[model samples]
Target chain A: MRSKIVLVLLLVLYGCSFFLRGEDPKLDLGDNVMEGVFFQGGYGMQWVHDTAAEFERAHPEITAYVWGNPRAWDQTRPRFLSGNPPDVFWGIHNINFWVNLHDGLVANLDSLMEAPAYGQEGVKFRDTFFDGTLEEGQFEGHQYFLPITYAISGIWYNKGMFDEHGWTEPETWDEFLALCETIKQTGGGVAPLTHQGKYPSYFGMIWRGLVYKLGGEQLMCDMDSLVPGAWSRPEILEACRLSRQLYERDYVLPGTSSFSHTEAQMIWIQGKAAMIPCGTWLASEMKNALPEDFDMRLMSVPGFRDGKGGIGAMEASAGPAFWIPVEAANPLAGMEYLRILLSRKMAANFLSTVGSVQPIKGSTEGVNVPPATQSALDRIAAAGGETFAFQFSGWYLELENEYRNALGALLNDDITPERFAARMEAMAERLRQDPDTIRFSRSPRGDGVAAL
Target chain B: MSLQNNGRVALLFVLPAFLFYLTFLIVPYALAFGVSFVKWRGVTLNMEYTGLGNFAKMIGDPFFWKSLYNTVFFTVLTGIIVPCMALYFAVAVTRKLVAGARFFRITFFFPNLISQVAIAVLWWFALNPEFGILSNFLRLFGFTDLPSWLGEPGWARAAIVAVKVWAAVGFYMVLYVSAIEGIPEDYYDACKIDGAGEWQSFRHVTLPLLSEMMKVTGVFLLLNGFGTFDVVRIMTDGGPDRATETLATYIYENAFELGKFGYATTIAMTLFLITFSLAMLSLWIQRRDSVEY
Candidate 1:
């Protein structure tokens, strides 16, 4: 039949179409060549390009190529699947570090960490980083990620406003509450505290700080490890109650829950609010929007008077982690590039250009940074052995989402602290029970930090 | 030419398009269906055959139920409201009941020309609680405490539906206009001679005459409502406690964000089936007695 002939012809043509499609052209990567793919986010790509150029200049025999965009991962993911990933990459939040590590796609950076520092005399590369910075990137006693930037989350306020009002930073929870009351009464329609309510994760740092203040770093580890009934602990409930008091007492900016992160920050910047909670990146992210007279400064979240982690305890973490693919063509060159990137000169350049701290110690020495960044550095220094960061949020995204939702509801006055705690515990229990969920156990390091 | 030769020629002409459809649509859909049966993390080739495990998970997941509920609510609400309002506007403009009918027709169809994402962003800014046009206008009327339109759970769902109707009513109005104009004028003349008023004429003659087009518009609106993604994605991002989370957004979150590729594919398969079944039901209902005037 004619129909049978047509069907046979179509099947043959479909088979021909497959044969007509040629194989993907292989890229010609020469000897000692390192390709870098970076995400061009708020910090931008100038620093990355400069670091690449420095690496090339140091090792003229090697060619270092760099390319990036805001959606660099969109292009890089396919390469990863094809086993032709870039030698080094940074600012990729799309790739799951745990999944990549489990699949052996991420390279262990132990050898790089044990190597000598790029320029520091007789210093191991690992010792060049600040304390508690590199710990987040390690797994099973081997480093798998290299955190390029260091950040500390705290309350940001205009130094000029504080000085004008003769308001000193609070050191204890009671003093913090008293200061909020004073600001509400005397500050002429200014709300005492505002947070990036659109992103409830911003408020998590405050609550985590409170948790550390109440029960020390071990409580945070227990919660992160999903220790049985950890969410029902008194310390977490108290932290939730204290955070909710800001909303219940109307000390928070009106309609803050509706504003985006930038919008909320602008509200604090425009002097409508006395203080805002944010990370050190606040300075750079809002650089162009800031008024000339704005003297942004940071302060660790105030602690309880009888707390375990002390008043000076703070939440600090290395951010925007960088990594080398396990199957990179020039893994050694990629390590070299990272080492050069963490050198004092480049770290200082990162500080000056990006208005954020690098994980490298002494990078801020003699470098003129924005007062807000300097304040973050000072806080990190003051915390000393007390700096702590929670691993649960980053480890379990479902838990993070539930926490954010509950926190948003609590801030919006739709739920009580008990209800919020119950919601979080339920989510934590689900994640702990779910065999498919990749749960990581964390133990408290001897020094007040949780090692994931 | 012989009838058999003519059929052969027609088959040859359809070959290119049929091949394209098979390659792009059929192949990918089949592949996705196969993937829905396995447990894969989306990044690598490591897959475990989980059989009905994903389906069991979907049945138990509260978020999946919430998204399905939202999707159904969105589809039904938009499906009913859009066509009714669009028909009203079309009749008004076509019958010259409203002044400046030509200008109104253009204005109604204006939103259809804008991309859905652009419209979402524009509405987002317009509905912002602080410094937004709506809030500022409300403030002028002594409404000191305006509700957060995009931030509250209840208001956010309502706002998304309202915006969807606003952006969609225009396109449907254009379709109805064409359908109305296509109806013969003799029927209206006959209705007028039979002592029928405007309402009676519309109820008897025009309504029956437009039934076929009504079926078409209903099906279109149903499809558009079921495929609601861009506007809600840009506006609420399924936020304010997963209030406006559509199946599409949840699919994206599961596949891309949470890396549950198999789970997301299962959700997509269910969505496709629901949309197809609803469309078929619509056709079945209308196929019984379609007016062909």
Candidate 2:
């Protein structure tokens, strides 16, 4: 009888612990005044949280919680689907992610922008941000998210190594090829270009560069729906031919398909590879992961000819944006907090600390940006280049998988370029037919292009 | 009164275990079945009744089919190779054929004690194509080139199977060793008295006795074959053209990576079905009367 009582007591204690552990209850504020903004964990997020706390102290009623990354997006989706998302949520520019979720789960920020409290701030914020960054946040003439950071994808090289060797950055595709030859002749045993070839997404990045060189920004806009004989077009064929040439010439790392992004980055840092095609994040990662003496520099990927820029030639901007959920306990409070964050002073602080380019005007000046990055930014601004859209964005999940698979097959020589294009067309066709796939206003209307 | 009291006591003793089985196993299984039929993106509260839509999609998905094929291939290879190797080692150890038999047994079993993830990382470095020990060694033998073992189609699958077999062999060997030791020494003595050769004794007496243990091991191996995930996940991540993808990894990718809960559950149901049927078939084949000796 005593043992049974002991067992019962233990069971009761175990059950009680389950209910005891969880997030603390949200603090209550009287009369719906400023409460706080919650953020997920990231290098950028830490800055946001710190800045948020300062803003709150200046205006005592407000408070903020900086949470860890929402690793359980699957577990959290049900709450989002129920229309009760967090008061402040993170947004990504990629299609079918946080920004698109705003279509159904979030309040239309456009409506919020029209409010008197928001109107002046909204217009000022809009003017300060780069046009391309702003354009990426708009869908169907309504802004769903605010672009927070701008990233440029390009070829990063060891500047010191180039200076010592008397080698200059290549200005054209032919020049780039010649540079590879020169490096090989000069007894640099390493490949000229290193990238994460195993991931099909990396291949898509190269394709984006080539496509931009061939047709400029318009090519990306019209990629989902191609005109008749698109695959057989001379420019597209040239892109494929050039890629194959690079492979045959052994200009890319041998066993390139085996290396992960991190592995490739390490190789580049160790001076094994002359150049690596990567994003602005590489600079910050290198600073943290490499020795202090590491001397890496970023450059816009070289052009295809004398004038046309290569793919990833200009800055590619995409990043997390802050949004207010409609079902928040204090929506007005959340909006006011966002306003504080978007202020020029706060934006500059974030940009400097996080190694990011803020989308606020005057935030770029006096900021401590690396010289190479500053140069790339200046070049993109000079060329009137806009945002580079991720090619697989705005497609169904299966369609994206198909593209990744096709690219993997292409890299392994399991499929020809013609077959790769055919497979992509097929995937696009499937997405067109799938009822769940979101259709943008600009989507192609008719069967002018045959379904693959 | 005595029989009835005994029956009540048996029921009382089983009640907790029965409740646990019902809650953890039966309830979740039923929930998963219900979930498999609906079109629910894991994140969204919204769900649509799709009946067999998810299953239908699974049948047509190339990745799904590829994963299933890989899983079967891995299972068959590991099931045959690991057990045979274990049995051979078991026989050798029991006969005291080698010096430091205990050391050999403990050393071989050491890998089984290490976490699968740790072992995978160790092997990954050892097999790294450019600077890895294996590739460097191969290059020394007049072979100037070698494929990345975990990064190519044929090789990735083979490497995954090899890792699984390596990790599993030791545990199964210990089982065989125990079973072999349990056999009465008198049987071998009798075989020698009858002028039976070593091979003849092993074929007749030892083989018959170990048959039951083999049946149990076979069933376990068959089930593990279908459910394998960690080694493959850590090693190849189902890449190099999805060559090393298995049903579990595919299901994980769908549910977590892609956020297609309905599709993932459907795949899981299919895996459970296959594993269940294979286990049942194995049990049927291995069924026999308990050995009296």
Candidate 3:
């Protein structure tokens, strides 16, 4: 009897391990069920849940099981490996979209894009979104990914503080520098500028804006395409020099480099710093911590006097990519879910809930947007479709990291502007030379060489 | 019952745990070993065989060398500093030389009870340059040119080491305290009966008997040092231009951030070899030098 009891206990333990490896029950719920996973980031998952519910309500034939967490990709990655991926997913930064496209993991969404809009009477699904917003998701003229939101990167400042201090928004690089100096002298102890230093890539937006200002949009395109010696251009070095001066002149907040994104933003919101560089999502992300009557506003990066791209060129693009796996159980359902999610009604709901804009055309119509996002929309309207986005950084991790690290080093005064340019050029050269490294090419917007 | 029946019972008891170990640990490691020789982008669907290529690439990569140097630096410094400080405190508290010995013991061990990520965040805040406790305290005097501890490369490494030591020394100190308490008091009494002074008695009796525990703690700390991921990941994120990039962080960056599974696993294999060899070498040295009491 004792031996039998011991054997039973061993068998029980083994059974428990097997139970631990059991598949998620939702997987066996049949074809009508569609699984959708998302990254619960700055924009909370309320929108995802609402969209899912709406999707299921609209298409009564399908059941949408959508879930998200801050780090949901950790769980989703294994599911992909096991050939049991969600029908639709978003925010797996590890999977390079281009590489996935090459490996036949991402479904080609060309037919979905060409399909008629879900709610609109006669508009194609592709036409429902704002112009130039859907271009980034295209690989070899086929859509493989779609963006959930749109954002414009710029310099954010407290309008209340600016008005009190008699500070006017600058339109040129020289005026911006003079304003910085004036702020340094008169704005009490507040620094002229601050940035998300721990995440050094925040500085890249400002740098890219400067690049576009000094050089033309074509120059930006050439650099993105990995054209030889493009990174070593004089315009690139000048942008490096101008950005470095922010640190050298002590215009940046002291010890800003040690701060996490939120810590730096908190300082900016506390009136410790006069301005900060961030995307339109900044105000929404910090809504809980913001003080009363902060009056946050964003301004485009000031252009140079001799710049080619003009001050109106705003670097606006879609954000937080979405994709459907090729092996999804319910591909049609997933596409339908996307159409519902991107409908103009849901887009307005997203703005009210998340305080950000979606790429859906006229999504901001009649929506009471927060002050900061309104500023971004105003900046975008003023640009009149003169916008550009860099695809190289998203495509190449090695080059992106090198550029970010080099930018950090340069800002810290650890390296010269020339050396910074050299490092970037060398990395670009290496990438261009490596046959195994997948490369993407594009021409300037409206250049007729690529489909804008 | 026969002796064979006892053996059968023991085998039955061990089988469940052994199967779990084989399935989770051994099989995964074997798979990783095979993957280290292939070129994979980590989507789990596509792989190309590249035998010895990943190894050669790792050998030639400057970033790998830098990470290795950083890892070794952290491990050696932590190993030396943590043990010495722990042993000293353990001796003091065990001997009751300090007042409020119980209070002191608990205070030292408190940090160990807290999570490592929490400790790192607390330290990161404390060392913040603008409004951090350390910076404000320094500024209370005339010192205004405070260095950015987490921003500058050299200072960031120093700061990481200090935080790791602070969080680690407590647990090791508790370990030493127990080991010292377990030493037979009769030996010390015998030393007192002789003309041996306190220092001499401790050197001859305490040091010799503690060697076994020392070896055990040494191996434990060595393993801990090698797997130093959480604190660094939370604190500096191997930043200030990768100045604090340890092998662990670099492996994570490669595999997850860059999707270079083959190269990451190759580095992992190398790290395992290095860790295993060093651990064995330390054990051999300890066994040879350990005094039989």
Lowest summed-lDDT stretch of 10 residues in model 1 chain B?
B39-48
DockQ of each: 0.42, 0.45, 0.60
Write one digit per residue (lDDT tens) for candidate 2, span A1-452.
99999999999999999998874445443443443333343343566676567666756755654343535344345556666555665532122453235345555567544543322343544455555455455656676666556777777887777887888877677888898887767836867777776566665666556765775544444564433344345555566666666777878776667777777778878877788878766766555667676676666655665433333356476543666666666666666666657666677777777776666767777788766567567656654553355434443566566666767667667777787777767666665676666554233212111111
What would the DockQ be for model 1?
A: 0.42
Cα displacement (Å) at residue A114, model 3: 1.1
Cα displacement (Å) at residue A352, model 2: 1.5
Instruction: Report the C-alpha lDDT of model 3 over A1-452, residue by residue, as the tens digit.
Output: 99999999999999999879878767675668988999887898889899989997897878888888777666677777778788898865555667677777889899999998877888999999877778889887778889987888889998999999999989888899999999999999999998888878888888888998888777878888898988989999999999998888889998888888999999999998999999988987898998877798888888877788767677777743888998887887888889888999899899999998999987888999887898888886786657767767788878888888888888888889899988988889888877668887877655312233
Q: Clash pairs of candidate 1?
A: none
Best by lDDT: 3
The Cα local distance difference test for each model comes to 0.84, 0.69, 0.86
Better model by DockQ: candidate 1 vs candidate 3 = 3
